[model samples]
Target: MPLVDKLLILAIGAQVFLAIAILVLMGRERVPRVMSGEIPVADIAVERSGYPLKARLLSNSFDNQFQLPVLFFVGALLLLQLGFVSWVDVLLAWLFVALRIAHAAIHVTSNDVPRRFAAYSAGLAVLTLFWLWLLIRILLVPSA
Candidate 1:
């Protein structure tokens, strides 16, 4: 494997870790409430009046794992699949991962909308750049 490929894998690994952290947080926050009859089981399927703020934050963070992060996974895999590897790709991948982590941290901790949005927006930009860079490379460089 090339160094760029390894870097992408590591960045993806960081994303997986963030997902696991959110899962664990959800478990810690939800389990106690559910067991204590504070949060009803049926309400777990969606955000509702019965849902507490901490649980909602964790749930939202977890849901976000399937959102923009999907683009990250696809972009990383596509880069590797088509052999478009470079330091720029690696840097942008890491930047996306970092911003995502920041978003999650703000979400689950303070639930700060502005800070979280900034992180998420920056992450989306990084993801877009990654995709655009890959597309340009694919169009310009003929595969040998």
Candidate 2:
């Protein structure tokens, strides 16, 4: 596997970890509330709590994993399928993964909108550039 492909796999792993973290946090927050009769079982899916702030943050972060990260996954796989490996590609892939981790940290901790948006924007820019590079390679470079 190419380095870029490995980075994409790590990125996907990060998302999976985030999802599991969300589930754990949700149960921690909800189970106590339910036992206290503060909320009904049917309302569990509604994503609210007497202290809903953390749960909402986790939910939002989990949802973000399926967004631009999808493009990152697809772009990486396309490059691998076409055998377009390059150091630049690997660098950008790592950048996207780092920025995504920072984004999640900001989101789940401080919940600062501006900081979170900046991190997400930086990651998106890296991913977009990766796609553009892949397109140029596919369209212009002669395959060996």
Candidate 3:
């Protein structure tokens, strides 16, 4: 496989693994509480108000995996499909993933808004550049 393809695989794998880890962490917190009738099924079913802070933190972090990274996923596939892969693109992609992991770590641990926002903003900026760079590259290239 090409290096870009490998990067995409690792990126996807990382997101998947993170999601699974969050699920396990949530299960650790949720199962006992639910089984003990501490949190009603209705509350969890309707909304997360019933979930405690720890579960909420993990849940929010899990939710983030689906957010901005969606663009990364799409952009990655586009890059592969269009054969527009470059070292700069790969570096930005890795940076985005790393920042997102940092954001999730802070969110689930300290729930620190300032630090989380810094990581999130940086990742968002990188994602924006990723897309903008891809778009510029596509527009600059003449169709065969």
Query: Which candidate achieves the best lDDT against the true structure?
Result: 1
TM per candidate comes to: 0.91, 0.80, 0.92
> lDDT scores for all predictions?
0.90, 0.78, 0.88
Candidate 1 residue pairs that clash: none
Q: 1-144 in candidate 3: lDDT tens per residue?
A: 688778766876786687788889988988999999998898899788799999999988888889998888899889989888888888888888889889989999998899999999999999999999999999999989
- The segments of candidate 3 whose C-alpha lies over 4 angstroms from its true place after superposition are none
lDDT of 3 at 15: 66
Model 1 Cα shift for residue 25 (angstroms): 0.7
Count of clashes, each model? 0, 0, 0
122 in model 2: Cα distance from truth in Å? Answer: 0.6
lDDT order of candidates, top first: 1, 3, 2
Residue 118 local lDDT, model 1:
92
Q: Show where candidate 1 strays beyond 4 Å.
A: 43-48
Give the root-mean-square deviation of each candidate in angstroms.
1.6, 2.7, 1.3
